[model samples]
Target: MDIDVFYGMCGENHKRLETIEHLFRDCEVSARIWAGLDLGIRVENAKSLNMTDWIIDWVRYLLSREGGVKRVIMFIAILWGLWIVRNKIKFEGLAMNSRVISGLLFESINEKVRTLSDQVDGENLKKCLKGGSGEHIEQKKSEIRDGHPLQMIGNQEQCNVIRVEVDAGWERTYAAAFRWVAYDGTGQECMRRQVRTRAESALQAEALGVRDVLLWAASGGFLHLDISSDCLQLINEIAGVDKEDHLIAGILEEMRGLSSYFHCLCFKFIPRHFNGVAHGLARQALKL
Candidate 1:
């Protein structure tokens, strides 16, 4: 049988031939999970390349990083999870969604992280797991100026800047919701907003949040701003270093256009622990 016919059409888009490229890159289910994992700029930049070249670039990139071993393990877990889900759907007629696959990948990675935390450098591995440490918690407290608990941690350069934290919750079968909260350098809540929208993937949902928040801030005349998200891939794409040639490309382009309106704007990636409030709001919005 032809490879395309054997693998079958992509579950996310039935019209496309289910080649490896389409399954891993173009399919909505895989695209969202990959985006959520945030492998780094190199992985994002390699998206347009063939699978062999992409894998080579990704492995080289991982091998050169400080906590590369942990990243490689997580990458393997994600791929394995994707494969398992794909096989289940193909062989057993199991219906899997992005949310389910993402959850499985995350859980598998977390379990691996926990098992390796003792053997590896705890601090670095914890950071790799996207979990903040006690030092981070204390730093977050010290950043608060007005005595109001913002539950946000900003970069050192973010002092006196409007730090906006954005997060999205996506369910393949249901609508996605995005929530953003703005905090002053001193960690005082300045503004908060939530919106419900339809998105085919979590990556698109995140890109939408970044685009909308940038437009909202620019319109409000917030010149000095720092946009942060738990989604590192989103930030990397916004910075123009990581190019994602997928469904979220248009949203990223809009963000690039809106970014020029600010006097001084920076995109940063925060660990999920530092972005608890905004993430919580996003999860809450999903239920509405």
Candidate 2:
């Protein structure tokens, strides 16, 4: 049973030797849980490759980039949550903690990518509300009621432009809920919010609901806001055209420093049927 006497010891000299890249990447609790998963690839720079060619060169550099399938399913859910916390610290002796194993590997990869983004947004909102015509699906539900879509931007006029619509509702017990809705410029609804905390993904609860709806529309002094979501990689990582180094990169750098307190912010990607009223108030704030 020589996988170093069936994974016996690796650090603090209890007799170091458990291989498979020393128990999943030079164990000291797997190098502090893969260096607390900032995931720009390390495992001691692929420790002279072996764990299946360092996970096939880190899933081929995250499938050649751009939110590559949610960063290769969050690097295979943090290497299957560090091999189930190294088999629950070697058969239940249990007591490891790289922040509770990277918060249960980002809450089980954000509740399996928010249940596969709600079954591909319920089949793309039933194929964009198929074949319309209940008065054209009530005029495309009054132009997405609030996620804005009537389309006009140069000189405003998508009624007059305000629309917010954010969403989030991850679970796996790290909990998470987030909502936002705003809608003015004729679609009506004016304001809305919802919270609930502790997020570890659903893209960090949609980047903390776009940094709390851009600090509540710049402290209610709102200006031409926009900010939609249905999480197109969190609107392509807040419009810098996608680049996220995991754990929602500090809530997308606090939503790009709250987009300099917007005088005219924007960010869109609607689809969950024009973000169905902020995804039904983020699944009614995760059922309260």
Write the residue-wise lDDT of candidate 1 on 172-253 in tens digits: 8858989999988788998999988778888788877877787778788887777778886775555444678588865554
TM-score of 2: 0.24
Error of 1 at 46 (Å): 35
Point out where model 1 deviates above 4 Å. 1-159
User: What is candidate 1's local distance difference test score?
Assistant: 0.64
Worst 10 residues of 1 by lDDT: 141-150
* Pairs clashing within candidate 2: none
In terms of TM-score, which candidate is strongest? 1
lDDT of 2 by residue, 2-21 (tens): 26454532334436446667
> How far out, in Å, is residue 66 in model 1?
52
TM-score of each: 0.45, 0.24
* Candidate 2 C-alpha error for residue 164, in Å: 0.8
